[model samples]
Structures are given as C-alpha cells and as structure tokens.
Target: MTSNKEDYLKVIYEENGLERPVSNKVICEKLGIAPSSVTEMLSKLQKQGFIEYEAYKGSKLTSIGGVICIKLLRSHRLWEVFLIRYLGYSWREAHEDAHLLEHVAPERMIDRLEAFLNFPETCPHGSIIPKNGELFENTQLVKMTDLKVGDIALLVRVEEDGDLLDYLERSGIIIGEYIKIKEKEEYEGSVEVLQKEKSIRISYKAACQIYVEKRR
Candidate 1:
C-alpha cells in the first residue's frame, strides 16, 4: 500500500470510518484535491478491498484498511513526540516533519521510540496516539466554539494547521492550559478567551477546529 493511500485511510478512520461512511467531498477537502481526483482514488481503494465506496454516498474503510490506518497514526504521533521532546521542535514543526517521517519509520523503531518517550498518551498537539490494535474513542471531546461564555475548559486537542498552531503557541494557548471563554461576539463570530491572565480573541472558524476537555 502506498503512503498516499495510507493517508487517505487515516483521514477516513479519523472521521469515523468504522461506524459510518464519509463523503467524497470531505476527503477532497482534507486532502486539498479535486473531486474528480478523490473519486478516482476511492475507486482504486475499493477494488483493493481497502474501502467500500458508493457513487454519491461516500467511502468506509474495511477492517484491513482500519488496521493500516491505526499503524500509520501510531507512527505519526510517535514521531511527533520524538521531534518535540528530543529535537526541540515546536508543536507546528513537529507535525510538519512527522508527516514525512511516519511513512518511512520502521515498526520496531517506533516501538523503541514509544518506550523512550515514556509512552506518552498524545502528540504535542494533544491528539491521541493510538495503541497497536487499539481503537481510540473521543466521545467527550468538544469543539472550542461549543463552550459557553465564562466556562472554563482545558485545551485538549488542536487541529494540525501550522499557522494556527504557531499563533496559539505564541498566544499561550498551550495544551493542558485552562482557558475561560470570556466573550462570544455573535455579530463578529469570534470568541474572546482568557488564558494565563491574558486575553485573546479567536475566530469562529478556528474555534470550530480546536477541541477542549470538560472542566474537572
């Protein structure tokens, strides 16, 4: 299986491929490719038993494809951890580099790296690192935009956008940090949040991409 196909499976798996089919439009958007290209790739994957696809419906990964996707995720997240903890790479840099490293890293090397990193639960961006043969479930995850005004929550997972990641890091929105939503500008569709005694305004689009944990 090519890494490009693995990448597609990974996205499908993340978007609940095990439970439901994902639209071709979603795949096209995630991959930043044209709809025609997505359709052609889906056809190839389906023929290989990696996925089930319908013309207008969507695509869902088969059991074999799901396993491959998990392995891909494990390698990617492990590399992200190594890059951040050992090489001093920032959150955004780690993800960008890990994307290439994950495809070439050996299984044994990843296993050793996992132990060396003390078996971290997540990557630098707070995304879960799936265990071998283990499925990850994030039922408690909530988008930053869903938080009510004055509500306090922990920044758990961040979408892997380099600019957004850098901006959040600069603004002190680090993972595990407690952020309180101070204001929700209905007209402007932006959110004002308080983090570490400083105030920051987040665009509604960005808020929808960030995930936060419920206050404990």
Candidate 2:
C-alpha cells in the first residue's frame, strides 16, 4: 500500500553501485516530502528488514530487499523501453506514465511484454539491463563543460530526470555525437559546440550535467 517500499528500495538500489550515500535529503527531494517524513518511513522500513537505517545518517537495503528492488527495477525499465519503442509513446512521456504502471505490472504481463518487445537489450535512454544478481559499473562520463581548447570529446549520455532534460533534447544535443568547445562566451558562460551540420550555443549548466568521452 506504499510507494515508500519501492521508493526507498529504488534509491538504495540506485546508490548501491555509486560510491556515496544518497542522503536523506536527496530522497526527500525526489519524493517531494518533508525531511522528517523520509526519516519516519525509513524507520518503518528498517524494522521490516528492508533496510538498515540510522538517525541522521542514511539507509541501505537488507539483502532480501535488495533482491526485490533489483527485480522490480528490471521490470519497470524493460516495460518503459517496450512502451516507447513498440507502443508509440515518445521517449520523454514514458518515464512518468511507466512509473505508475511499472509498480503493478504482473509477472506474466512482464514476460509477455518482454517477449513481444523482443527482449530489448537497453532502455531508450540507454541504461543497461541489470540482472543475474550482478552489480553494474557506473557509466563512463565527464562533464561536457570540461572540454578544453582543442580537446576532442563525444557526448556519451545525459542525465534524464529534470526540467532541463526536455530542453536539451529540443536543442539537438543527444547521445553519440562528437562535440567540442569552439569558444566559451565571454559575457555569458555558453559554449559554442558543433554537432553534425550545425553549431549551437549550450549553456554552462546544461553542459556540466552531460557526460562526454575523451576522443582517443
């Protein structure tokens, strides 16, 4: 009866491979709740053996809860990709709609959808399918703003969860394109970058969040 379970579990699941604690404040922000509410739910979760919670510290899933989180996440992401690639929703609209349906997707439905979608290898945003109880390595990335004069880099990925994400997509910055900082604006921090056939100005804030690979 609570998204609290999936919410906490997913946060823990996401942070498991990262080298940092996703602070209670982060969970608060994600859920749009008071900090105290996060603490209250976390306490309940800890008692349920879903996570080990500490006051003013943070939480991590107990092993049993970890397995559930992984399983549910695999289902949600797989369904999201299926909906977008096969069912005609655009990439941007799917995450929120799928968020609701994903939690209730039946096991049989999941299997049928997977088979029908041909068992996608990756989600639309390019996240890998995590399975077989194996932890995934963090994706390789660097801030797009970090490109220096004459440094060659390719835009590898964009973090897809904010107001600015849609804005970036409309601006023609997407994954798998080569980009370089042609000039850094003196009045503002916009960087001039060239994609395929055109050059455009990208704000410093947007550039900083996108990950890029050094050309080698």
Candidate 3:
C-alpha cells in the first residue's frame, strides 16, 4: 500500500515519466520536505519493492508500484475535477484541497461524487480521468519553454498551484489551447506564444513549467 506522500509523488511521475528518473531533490521541492527525510523515505520505498533507488542515478517505480500509483493519481485528478466543477473550487485551490480529499475518499464516496459531479471525463486542469482506473503507458514530457518559433503544440499540462495557477486562468491560458511559439528570447528566456486570435508573452520559468505535447 502506498502512503499519501507516495501518491502525490506518483502524480509528478505520471505527468513526467519514470524512464527518465526523478530526483529526490525535485520531490522534496514539490512536497516541501527535507533532503534527509526524502532520502530516508526513498530508502524505505526501495526496500519495499516500490521503487528502484540508486543513490545519484535517481529513482523509478517498479511495475507493481507504478500500477497502484497511477490509480491513486486517477483518483486525485478525478476529485480535482469534482472540486472545481461542482464544489466551486478554483483550479489553483482545488489541487491542494483535492490532495486532502483523494486519500480519504472511499469507493462509496467516489460513486456518490461521480453521480454528484456528473462523471467528468477530465480534471479542471484538463488531464484525463481514467475509466475503471486504466493505466497509461508512459510518454515523453516536454516543457513549453523549449519550443522554437513557429512550433505548434498541444497544451498537455500546466505546472500550477496556489496563486500562480490562478494567474494562468486569468491570462486565458488553459489546456487544449493550440498554440504557436512565435519568438524565443535566448538570453532572458522569455517566449511569445500565439493562441486563438491573440498573442501573449510569458517568462522562461512559466513556460518551462508548462509541459506541452508537440503537435507537429
């Protein structure tokens, strides 16, 4: 059985990829934990056959662990959708609050939620809600900032939470918005993006955190 912290890490894993391996430092930063604690918990997870942990080489999940993790993520994303759509939680606040709800949710509540929320197919963040908790094969994860001018891409996912995610929504950016990278400033690392009939520019940090799927 995976812990709540493990479930959150799995969200990062699913959004990113297990093949590339994610570092403990990145996990710590995301979860706001100390390095020593991450190391200790990682060691325990490795011993439990949940992950393959090799000191500096980073870590990936075992197939056994990966399956459960994905289901937890499915639960998390579904609940996020419910909170945002029915519960009136903004996309930003929904993320953290959903994390609290996902763990405690029982199948009965999930069924009630599905009925109450009308069986949403995607989260407010625009990620898929797996049916019957189906697992997905891992895919390449690329940040939006890496795109070159004239590149077209699908808005896969945005790295947002708290106030920043709120800003993204206010700026008219959302998942499934087909966008073209119009200009890339190499030095300061800002990128101009065009979507719909309007064009906007966001900083390197923002773009780098917003992952996209290349649409050729």
Stretches off by above 4 angstroms in model 1 are none
> What do the candidate models score in CA lDDT, each in turn?
0.87, 0.71, 0.74
Model 3 reaches what TM-score against the true structure?
0.75
Query: 1 or 3, which is superior by lDDT?
Result: 1
Error of 2 at 27 (Å): 2.1
lDDT of 1 by residue, 1-216 (tens): 778988899889879987899999899888998989888888999999999986677998899888888888888898999998889998889999999989988899999999999999998888888886685766798999899998999888889889888877786666878999999998867899998998998888788889998785
The alpha-carbon root-mean-square deviation between model 3 and the true structure, to one decimal in Å, is: 3.6
Error of 3 at 101 (Å): 0.7
Q: Where does model 2 exceed 4 Å of error? A: 15-22
lDDT of 2 by residue, 57-78 (tens): 6776778777777667668778
Residue 76 of candidate 3: its Cα lDDT?
80
Best by lDDT: 1
Q: Could you give candidate 3's per-residue lDDT for residues 10-57 as a string of tens digits?
A: 744754636667777787787787889888887777888777876686
What is the full ranking by lDDT, best candidate first?
Answer: 1, 3, 2
If both were scored by lDDT, which would come out higher, candidate 1 or candidate 2? 1
Best by TM-score: 1
